[model samples]
Target: MTTAPIRLGTRRSALAMAQSSQVARALERVSGRSVELVQIVSEGDASRASLSQLGGTGVFATRLRDALRADECDLLVHSLKDLPTADAPGLLLAATPERADARDVVLTRDGTALADLAPGATVGTGSPRRIAQVRGENPGVEVRDLRGNVDSRMRRVRDGELDAIVLAAAGLSRLGAEIDLVAEPRDLAAWPAAAGQGSLAVETRADADAELLETLRALDDPRTRFAVIVERAILAGVEAGCHAPVGVHAVIDDDELRVRAAVYGAQPGDEVVVDRAEPLAQEYIRPQGSGKGADAASRVAHERASGIGALVAGLLLDRGAAELISPSTAS
Candidate 1:
């Protein structure tokens, strides 16, 4: 008997298409089921206004999720960072595939690194975190709010419309754009990434097809899942949005997962609160049998990650992170 093709919802942007195509191929490979792309135009993609004005966080994922709920598509793919921490009713964040490089890259016309950029240089980026970090690092450089697709942003650097632009290394890699100066993940003390920056979220309706759900579970990556879990937990704990001048990066060190968080106030030149969580065990469940306990390990990782995240957040708040970001934050 033949089965109907699974519909994977995606945005029409080049980056979105590239990522969604990857998910489609993975699903077909694991499930042996045909897949089709259903383009869903997101409000974020349609609007020319700032992301905050258009409603921060989840703007890109909202319409696709609406499509999934309306049965217009079977599932949707999203950049995990674009997903808001708030739970979506009737939707399950089913899986997070393996992550890519989670670093910020500075693209310049002269192939200059962030450290070498000239004083008063005009840098392009709409991210508050990047703005604050740039100012913190080099108080002279000017960061302008930039908005556009990957190619459009890159054009500014090449055409000399701007001296430089900061972008996600994972996005540049996925788009296959040539970038010379990347702030590596190893330099997290100076440039932590946005929570879930390099991860992909596979979301489906809560009442999704059982076979499809099984296929999604097969695509889950425990390490990636847990790493983003830690990162996102920190974000949620701080009550921050994608546009918030907050950065969180989580990584596995030996047998433990370590989460680093950075929060900046509204002013680009203001001080930042940088703190980390105690390294927690990578897996809560002991490995046994042929390693089929991956799901159980992920659950344990989530729990531990959450606990560590809450602890770290409380520490930062005590250190004045809340007041730094929002002057009106209750004491």
Candidate 2:
């Protein structure tokens, strides 16, 4: 018997559609059920205001999440970084596929590196984190507020309205957009990305069927899920919204998970940073998802990961991260 297709809700932007289509195909392969993409325009997509002005954290996710809760869609795909850390009522983030590159890249009109850009060069980005990072790297450059789809933002550089722009490398790769400009990759060691950056979040209602949940679980990459959990835990611990100037990156190496977090002040060169690593729980290092025993192991691993994240967040707060990342200072 043929099953009904899974309706996956996603934003209508080019990047969103591309990534959601990938998830749809993957769901089809794993569940042997067809999937349909439902185009949903979020407030973030419809608004002209900056992310900070739109309240940052849930602007991109709230509407789509509402659709899932109301049974308008069976599942939803979200750019993980755009999702708020707080859990939505009656919703579960079902899976996070293997991550793409999590680093931000600098795109320029004339093949000039960010550092080589002339003094007073105008750099455009809508993210507070990128604004602080750009200022920290080159205080002389003029950082301007910008919002739009990827193509429109790139057009600003082409039209000589801005000298450079910062964007996530994953979006460009997913869209397969041919960028003719010089794209310089930022070093994650020094320039950490937003929590859960470059990851896709698949969410569904909490009351989803056991079979469907299992099918979605087939898409989860334990390592990717663990990393993002830790990173987002730090974000939550600090009580900073997604729009705050906070950057967190986490990676698992062998038996250890290492994280780097930064909270930037409104002024350039004023920031609090925390770098920490912990040995992963044995269950986490081993492969997961076999049976009840594996499920128990997964729970234990998640607890340990969250504890480590809290520890790092405490360290940052001790060093004044809270003061630097106040809501009023987000922009």
| Candidate number achieving the greatest lDDT relative to the actual structure | 2
Q: What is the lDDT of residue 308 in candidate 2?
A: 82
| Candidate with best TM-score | 2
lDDT of 2 by residue, 1-331 (tens): 4499889999999999999999999999999999999999899899999887888888989899989988999999999998888889999988899999999999998788887888999999988899999999888899999999889999999999999999999999999998977899999889999999999999999999888888998999999989999999998899888878999999999888889999998899899999998887656745677668877887887887788889998999999988887755332
Q: All models: lDDT? A: 0.78, 0.90
Poorest 10 consecutive residues by lDDT, candidate 2:
322-331
Instruction: Give a tens-digit lDDT track for model 1, residues 1-331.
Output: 3389999999999999999999899999988889999999999999988775776677788888889999999999999998888789999988888999888877777667676788988998887778888777767788888999988887887777788888888887788865543332327656788889989999999998677777888777777877787777777877777768888888876776667788887566565555553655534423322234755665666787678777777877778777676522210
lDDT of 2: 0.90
Residue 187 accuracy (lDDT) in model 2: 90
- Stretches off by above 4 angstroms in model 1 are 178-186, 277-279, 282-298, 327-331
